[model samples]
Target: MASFDKKPTFAGLKLRLMNSWMFVAFFIGFFLFWEYSVLWFDIPLYILTPPSLIIENGAADLPRLLDYTLVTGTEVIIGYVLAVVLALPLGLAIAFSTILKRTIYPFIVCIEMVPKIAFAPLFISWLGFGLLPKVIIVFLVCFFPIVLNAILAFNSLSEELTLFSRSTGAGIWRTFFKVRLPAALPQCFVGFKYAAINATVGAAIAEFIGSDEGLGFYIQIVTGNMRPDLAFAGIFFLTLLGLCLFGLVTLAERLLIPWHISVRRN
Candidate 1:
């Protein structure tokens, strides 16, 4: 009879530990250790629940948590879309017009300099405890990075390229579409990646400030009820959402800019 199993080789084990699988293994190991330590230390559930308990609570609360997650996710998506729509044209204006670049950009920079959290209460008061306020807060949090990066991308092109396009009889729109836009796409994605992560935090902050819905509100309620495990479960979902969004943006960037040195190397 043929043998069904082979001994694990050192090389095979080393390769496995060096790749993405190792990340998954490390997280599993951490949670296992956390569970064992909590039990061994006789920690109170309210103070620090074990991973197992947190999982249990998550399973029990999954439906409600998912509902909240959906609400928060909607706000993040809407805000990010709005920021993109508004920031791009403004960024182009900043890049193409000397007056706008020198004048309006300073005011924009000054506005961005203010702490984003400071505006949460103002947004809530202005828009009330509704989706509008949450979306606006998320927009404010993510808008700056998109605009700044877009301007940088647009302006990074050499004057030689612009003259070359003009020499070829390419119209302004054609030059912009064919040359500058393609050149700017990679950096635009960098902004998108940053915005994706920030949008989640922004939504959470908005929810925390004034809302009965979303993961942030759920966490607040659970924490107030002294259910740290459930609160942490909500946090876990938010983290997953942010990571997923960031990953999606990264994937899109790689797909769109495969010719770019950064993408090719990766």
Candidate 2:
């Protein structure tokens, strides 16, 4: 067999680098305009702080911000892992069994219909003002999307594909792992992306409702103290956290499903 693996040359890499630079340029331009607009309009410092001020103060307060950041990041990561652990097996079981689909799935939908944020206070009351409650809140918020996507992925596989795998002398487990799992991976990743985005929000909500630490609590404190600039700084960091998590999930999808059409197209 002829080997086809090839590393991207510098010329090819140059295009991607230029694209990234364009994004950075646009980002810088946006902030410059924002800073100028705020300064020119004589906006109150407490009302709208310039980007420079946010960066300066944020850097000065980096240590405290980092400490709280780790707290929130921990909650999001732990909750995400737990949701995946619980959802994947449950989803598989539900997909494989009509009993689960008929009996348990309806109740699951009903539970999903209830606002997940409403349970944040209950979790705090039950678990107290600690990491546990925040993690549970994240788990509850992220779990449903994963399970639903899993079910959709499994059902979307054509019947002919399953029959073909069996005809090749593959048992149920072999067929699932080889044929069905690969087919389902794209949709599974779709769930993962959504869950990743929601995970941070869930942790933040829990912190806002009842916690002494984390970025959400930090934002609440700063806003209450009439320091909108510092609150905006917190918001900036929170946005970065969400984007980083979402990027990681996207990278994983690209790696794991490289042969999938969507991955190839991208």
How well is each residue in 1-266 modelled by candidate 2, as lDDT tens digits?
12323468998789888879979899999999999999899998888889889889888889989898899999998999899899987888899899999987888889989989889999999999999999999999899999988888887889898678878998888888888998999999989999999998998899999999999999999989878878987888888888988999888887788777776676
Candidate 2 residue-pair clash tally? 0
lDDT per residue (tens digit) for residues 1-266 in model 1 = 12322468999788877786878988999989998999899888888999889999889999999999899988988898899899988988999999998898998889989978789999899889989999998898889989999999999988899789879998889988899999899888888878898999999988988999999999999999989999999999999889877888888886677678787664
Candidate 1 structure lDDT = 0.88
Over 4 Å off in model 1, which ranges?
1-25
Model 2: per-residue Cα lDDT at residue 212:
95
In model 1, the Cα lDDT at residue 239 comes to: 92
Query: Model 1 compared with the native: what TM-score?
Result: 0.90
Q: Which residue pairs collide, candidate 1?
A: none
